[model samples]
Target: MKQISSSQLNREIIDLIQNHPEIDDFEVLAIDLSGHFYGKRYPIASLKSFASEGLAFPRSAIVVNTLGEPLEGIYYGEGDGDPDAQFSLIPGTLSVNDWGNKPRAQIMATASSGKEATFFEPRNLLKKVLQAYQTKGWHPTVAFELEFFLFSRKRDDQGLIQIVRNPKTGRPDSPTLLSNTRISDFERVIDNIIEACNQQNIETGAVSAEMGAGQFEINFNHHSDVMRAADETCLFKRTVIETAKKHGMMATFMAKPLLDQPGNGMHMHISVLDDKGENIFNAGNKPQQRLLHAIGGLLDTMPAAMSFWAPNINSYRRYSGGSSCSPVSLSWGHENRTVAFRIPLAKDGAWRVENRVPGADANPYLAMAVSLAGMLHGMNHRLDPGKPCDGSVENGDEYLPLSLSSALAISMGSEVLIDILGRDFIELYCQHRKADKVAFEQFINAREYDWYL
Candidate 1:
């Protein structure tokens, strides 16, 4: 990433303050391991100095679990005294917080501590992976398709979540794949969400109703710079949640928010470009050998990368559900959604692979980082991807880790991931996830009593 000069940032901040006088406050955000934003809000008076001076939070803040609790038995948590972690603003992220009630602005920042960038930070991890491509004069153009469900604010007596009701007819929403009527029902809410995304500089493309009731899929425009694409994905999630809240609905990216409903997924589409700005995955409308090699690398690394894809316990539930789109096999095929990696049918320069294993709840930065790393490994080793499966294939030659514990165990000793993502991040991630697993196990859910009784 290019660094922004101090003078340039000063001028930009000055212009922002002058132009948006209604913005009386600003929120600086740093993405955590769980893909949640952690930061403090400051008054407009401190915006300028805050930019140069930066801000500080506990080092453990970036490594917290989904519940926002610091993991035990790690240097970031109880093992080491939680020290102050510093953060510097990421250039080009400052935008108006249009979803908020008051006129406020927000910006994303990079994590650091004592003059060194935090190795375990998800964004920093992605930067490390991108460096490998940078050294080889290869660039990745990437986009993410996010699926989510909207629910009513109220819950049943048992605290189970209920789907959103149509405001016009007061009827409960039902699953209707690609129904224009469903999309029309939520037109005002969807329009507001898109408007908010536009204000945040997030380029949103198609918006369609999905298979789950109150579910929708939004497509983000592709970016030549993979880092910027990941950054916008993070911001887009926040924008959706806040914008939905404003319209009296609750949007959740949880992997399995409802047991009986189709789960949310975050599918990634990526294509590599050579130094000459040519798509290396295809040549003269035919798939290149390098594309197959990349698929092989993704297949070999999928088990190890599974922990990152399905980061939470509930994420595993998505794979078991009867959803054809949630791929579990190490399979790849042309225009097939049932496989882990699908080579979409496209024109010469538009050829790309769509990775469909990650849940919407996974951290986008880490997920994309591991995916790109796998491609690099495949191309470097010239690995062969076995024959592509035909229509409606169930299982592949090998299966992915289905449980969080199993995924962690496979990733714990993965030399491929360690070499690509560094030993510190790999070990810390495993330890943190294991800690979360233990915490999850200790909890006794209602299902346990219902079954045993």
Candidate 2:
């Protein structure tokens, strides 16, 4: 694909609306530290201005924790003087949301401030990692398999939380078995999701019902560019949540919702290719064992990387053993679900490792960034991960943190993470997450435990 310049992006925006006609507005988004969307929408008429000058948003808007607490030095420490950044819309990612009476086009944007771009911005972070591979005459491809839950809107008599269910099944909290296969009772919502993805030109591999009640997973096809993969994952979550709300259902990407059932996860499949467009993981004369060692690197860093994978307090709940889903140890085997990484037994280009540590709640940009960092470390240091774990991983020596606090502590001391993501970024991330952890723990005291969950 050819590189798009600002003038070219502006022209494309005008031409896009002219050809599509249904698109009335465009959303320019920036992924903040929390991996949440921090952006503004503009009328199509303002496309030229937005494309050229970009939108002016408070730098503080992207630096705070979810609770809005300001990180002391991250935002203002650099001097807050109108810290504006350009947002160039990715051409192919433009899509329409038709849930409203009028359709609106949505586009993902990468933020750039002066010569030094914000590396913490998820998209930019992924772009930077991809550049590292590009410089080595290699390219990275990624696929996202995301899982999430759908909950009923109704509350209990005393105003406590409860799960919605199928009336015929007589199970109030049981999963709803909608008769419409193509379009469940949630058809309109799913349709809206499909529409948004199609409008954005994101390739949707499949949408399927998961094991848990009211749970679903959407898998996206692998893209050679890491940015496109991260962009798609970000948009997927936004589309699901927005569409679910329109249909009176709550869509949650929370890692674990119910203690007993399966928890949501975001598994990433990655592979590297050479400048000649050849799969580097493939073995013709070269042995595939080298690829296994790369998987080992990911396994070695699995514990430290958990902070990025399961960023929130609720994320660790997904790590329970009985589910046969979540990974309990750092191990990899061919097509193994019990292991942290799984090497799918497939053809040359199809061979790749699926890193299962990340929960659906993770920011795809950070997840990809950390995953690339691990792979690159393995490639550079030649770290050979031992034999893959077989059967249950409960007894396995390698284990991930049991809570967000533990994960943060490990991440804070991770030399590899600091080396790759930079000390400043790591410090900023840990500070924000540490604050979140403290707030969440304080709020969830013994008296409030049952009420909050």
Candidate 3:
């Protein structure tokens, strides 16, 4: 779908509230560095105020690192710092926040200036990359398969810690079968999540209980525009988390929680269509092999792309050698989860490549943008990826980063990433992530390693 303008967005919001009187307040949300939702809630009557003058938020909101530290002079205060950015609501995303006790409608917002200039907002970043595909007369479709875990808040005789445990099982949980096989405990949480998604017009291809005890996966319908797909993902995660809280449970997108259990993954399936809306990846005589080169680009840049895939320190724990779903190297095979990339063997339209590198903790917009950037680089250079791996991709030498520090270094050193994402954005991102890594290191003392894991 095409991007709607400010006036169109206003009309859509007004019509929505008018039709559904149940919505009393409108919540405008922005995604933060930690993948947390941050925004303000306004009464439905004040919708006109936002539509006319646009909602104003402090410049400092986007400047801070994940730990909320200001980066000194980089603040770029108002006329100099980050200007109070404007956030106009997205048309289709208007809905009530499921977790809120009061009646409220939620809308996704983008950072914009008075002159209609868009800044380096996370969502806008992906929009620019999608526009690049449009410039080349190509349309890209993407579907994300997201996996996460459920946990009950943990408490000791002393107090509560961030570490949680599965409610059904008393001890640290595993993915195997348990005493509670009825799935009744999670029924309300799942139902609320599905209902919230429906309210936001987010489409779900399927939802299933995963291998882990509280682990679950939700597959979204493919979208022709990458921005829409990312937006839907961001909204979906928020909905799931909020709904879970209502049921007195915690939902974590953390990549890996328990050592031996399966880590949560965000597997992205991508395909490109030409001007005629036909699958470009499927038209060739040897489509699977041709797609290999695209896979090559992904594998070639994966080390550097790790910053986007595993943004947090805890994220790297997901890349274990023996995990069936974890990819150890830059390799692709038909329907093989052992490799970094998998070409699902299916019909014409269903033909797509699944990049399994990213953790569930990744930022959807950045992950998708970096991935598209890699594919574009490959398509432009006409790079050949050689051959797909046969059985396993576990070459010790070719393995991805085992920690966040190594991943950050790879991202900073990537020339291809610099060329595509632009030097300024790369530098900014690196600085932010570095600060996060340092803070995390300090927060967890040498004796606390086991506690976090």
Candidate 4:
């Protein structure tokens, strides 16, 4: 991970305090492997000391289950005596978080153990991949398009999810794909989200209604710095969640939040730039060799990379077929949305590949890292992506792992992935995921009672 000077962190806090004197509290947080933020809050008076001496978090906390519980066999939890992992704020991340009742400031931090990046940290994995790109004089430009759903704050009598009603018609909302009227119905919520993003220095692009009821997608502006893009994505998720609550609606990023509705996806747009700042993937409106190799690498490695994108049990439901808009095979094509890697219609200079396999629930840092690693692997070996499909392809579940257990098993056996990401990290991640699956299966759902009774 990139190091931030203590002096720079201090200056940022000072500037924030000078600008917003009403900020009575400060929150310092670190991103966990599950994409959840955990940290401590302090009064304004402690900001100065907090900048110099960082907070202490357990190293085990970095790789906990989605519920933030310590897995039984993980060595970091009790075997290591629960050692503290030092955390300091990332420079330029300190900003005013006014999405609350009272104005409070927040900062995103990174963890280090004895001045080295922790093996369990997702940010460290991404940093390692970025360094590999830097060695080859290549830079990656990336943007994330996140799809999510808004539900009523109240649930049904049976505790099932309920769609939010249309403010205009006062009726239960239904699929209103790309409907301008549907966007207008939630204008206030969208406006607040945009304003919140602006306050946090997050660059946003188009906002449109999606194919599912109360569903919408927000596109982020492309960034030359991939790390900043992932950082802003983490912040943007919090912004959308808080802003939705302000409007009496709850927002969810679950890949398949509702059983019958379309699943949410996080599509990544990525292009590689050479030292001369030329897009390597662009070749005069034709497919470039580098681009094809990159696609080939991604397709070949999708089975191993599945555990990173589809980390949860519910994530596989997104690819269960029937208008899910989720990719179920490792196909690639030009101007086709049905494939895993879509070379979207763009001019020569702006040409890039869009990876649509990741669910909105994935950790942005890890997802982007694995994608880059696969592309590099493909280019180094000059792998071919096979023939491009002209039309829609059938859902070939056999081409990819469709279960959490199967995905993790494939990930553990991938020598290419182990070479890109460290062996320790891969083993630890698979173990953690297996622990989560065990916990998930322990629960008896209502289906068991309905079917067996």
Candidate 5:
């Protein structure tokens, strides 16, 4: 008899079950530092009970690297046994995955204990920074533009990654570079990706062909709630990967999947709203103190935050000038793709700043946390970001930690960053990244055999 709000209606797992009876299975997922989600699938018959109580996943899930090897001294390993943290499902994310043979649904969940958010969790870390915004009566709106490559299992004669074939021509390459016609090559899977995002309420904006043979970019609309934006961004990446697999193609979010091709990147556009719901970043012709301080904070912290932005070793390979729009310097400019942070051209209230530091492989939750925290730090410290760069930045500008190892080292000693994202997360991230680097070092590459063997 009572009408429910759209959001409340979406959260009704029981209603979802009744509506989509075909969905017998559901995937409840949570992400680690590597942006890899781990969860168990369950039959829909137990959906309601499980949704109410939530699910418990290992705390080690947060500390481990891409290798899934756990950090040695973290809370997950420091204790005699790994502790379990119950994470509740994110409302409205119960998306129906009718892509493959399995007619299943999936939902994104966040780790939390009772009413308090687990500090170590990446999603929770973003929530903490959002709390800082809430305290100051400011709202941060964010959107993600993610670029990725579509590769078939087949490789070239040189063992190089080959792009997916054109559905129309049956040719294994994109002839029209950065053309919408190029999308026709992989139209089936691309359309599937669009449909999946729409079903998940991810508000996907545009799809465009990128410089890489198989690379494409998908844009998302802005969400005023930063936490929800982060969650949707995370889910969106997973959806892209999963749906691609269903179509017999591999979608890679690796920062630099191919050495000869353009690297994939995750570019985030940010705008803050005031108490009256007005975009506070609309600085008119001149820059406002708040906006400048925000930029200054980002620049000040950009070097240390590099560890999260470029989470893997391959991430740094994308930082070169030759790699289109992959910015490496701590510079901001008006609609400048050459700079790490750019103020896009828009109407007064529509103005937004884009942080191009994050690779497609970055954990959206952690990256957004870094961006929001930098904005807060700038305001709190009243810092100043200097003039924008005239030409393309080398990203090797002074004070920037360019390498993965160096970035991790800076992250280990950064008290300010620790205060922003939490010392425990910073520590685990550093240790785990070191292990990841070490693993790569211990192994000899085919190229190494060519040169030094």
Candidate 6:
């Protein structure tokens, strides 16, 4: 029940222990720029000491790239000698993990030496962007629709992933589009996932089988707290993956797990509430200037924000095709899935824009940061997005970044993004992406020699 935002660590720790005695241990988690949560577990009794001093983690934590390799040219590496940074909890994130091996509480954290937050931390970057909206008295409501693939534990002869079979009829893999039969076939898996999500208090709205075989999409309920929405996304991924393993299958959030099959995506839906708690996006079917400005902002910064949306080399493949609604161009439309931004057809008071750009593999914190920043920036500058498109936009606008290298180049050089996400975080994120690009390029894939050799 207690929340610690400042120096009330001791008092808050006491209150936490008194309130949540069911939890024996605590998982101190901190999300870095690479979207990786790295930290250790401590006994609940040790919260008094650890909470005050803050659990220590290396500064290199933020510099880690997608490949898990440390990206150089950062201030913490050579000059600062990779010193330890203090990590403190985000207060109310403490929750009992129903899916864990034992009774344990988990909390989100940020690492910094001073009272100010570290810009390189993904959560901090998001917080910084959200502050802009807060300053204008514009509250943001957000939700996420995550698509993932479930594969059997066993791999093929060549170690390729195969979809989990439907036990009843013994169907290997059928692209059953929204069939209730498919839901019953995977009832146990779906039920267990629901149980796990319920334990964490994650409000899930809908669960349905997607276009691909054994692929499913889960939708979270819309909420006013943007940070909590992002937190649920990270926790939902961990919950789904762990629960899948328990059910004798593996769940992957990879953008493109298969070359021929559909890729996974994380779609974000957003709307702003005014001071009177009214949806600003509810300005008729075409929407008001505020909604349009938000669209303009997202479209304007999307090219630079591509790296954050599609963080890995394999992430780029999601846009290449095969997926039903994966967007490839930088176009916005009214309820059109072919474009990056979509104003979904909704009833009155439910109006919103869906950012269909981010892949399932993206760091939720960073992706939300860039998306929000673009909107806030657009509103500030009153950027006009022009008219909306009605077409599917196979190749309407300019081409988006096709590789991590190109995405990194544009992200690093984007003054608007740099201003929103901060120069320190932008520079740091791009460096890590650049390192990952070089590493991926150096290692030639086996398929390369299939034709050449």
Best prediction by lDDT: 4
Report the alpha-carbon TM-score of model 4 versus the true structure. 0.96
After aligning candidate 1 to the native by TM-score, how far in Å is the CA of 309 from where it should be? 0.5
Give the runs in model 2 whose Cα sits over 4 Å from its true position. Answer: 1-3, 20-24, 67-88, 113-117, 157-161, 166-188, 284-287, 321-324, 396-399, 442-453
Candidate 5 per-residue C-alpha lDDT over 1-453 given as tens digits, one digit per residue, 9 for 90 to 100: 112423463467767777887788888888887878888888877666666666778767767767777655455655748767787777667778777686788877778633432667787777778888889899898888899888886778877777787767878776355697887757888889989888887788878888887888888888877777888877778889888888777788999887777788899988889899987777676556677788888888898899999988889888863446788777988777888888777775577778988999998988988888988898899998889777766546768887999899888988888887778778877877787677667776689889987
Q: Per lDDT, what order, best first?
A: 4, 1, 6, 5, 2, 3
Residue pair clashes in candidate 2: 95-199, 95-200
Residue 185, model 6: lDDT of: 88
**TM-score of every model versus the real structure:** 0.96, 0.89, 0.88, 0.96, 0.92, 0.91
Candidate 6 Cα outliers beyond 4 Å, as residue runs: 1-23, 72-75, 98-100, 112-117, 284-286
Candidate 4 vs. truth: CA RMSD?
A: 1.7
lDDT of 3: 0.73
The per-model lDDT (C-alpha) reads 0.86, 0.74, 0.73, 0.87, 0.79, 0.80
- Provide the lDDT at 421 for model 1: 93
Measured over all alpha carbons after superposition, the RMSD of each candidate to the real structure, in angstroms, is 1.7, 3.5, 3.7, 1.7, 2.9, 2.7
lDDT of 6 by residue, 344-395 (tens): 8878757888999999999998898899889887878888988778976766
Q: For residues 1-453, what per-residue lDDT tens digits would candidate 1 score against the true structure? A: 224555666777887888998888999888988888988888978877867887788878888877888666767757667788787787778888766667788888888533553888888889889889989999999999999999997899999888999867789898999988988889998988888888878889999999898999989998998888999988888888988888888999999888788999999999999899998887667788898999999998999999999998899899886553688788899988888899988874588899999999999999999999999999999999899978866663445789998899999988999999988789989988888788778778899899996
Name every residue pair that clashes in candidate 6: none
Candidate 1: lDDT of 321? 67
**Candidate 3 local lDDT, 14-103, one digit each (tens):** 687777888778778887655556788777888767766668776556646665566543433423646666666665666656578765
Say which prediction, candidate 2 or candidate 5, comes out ahead on lDDT: 5
**Superior by lDDT: candidate 3 or candidate 5:** 5
Q: Which stretches of candidate 5 lie over 4 Å from their true place?
A: 1-11, 69-75, 113-117, 156-159, 175-177, 285-287
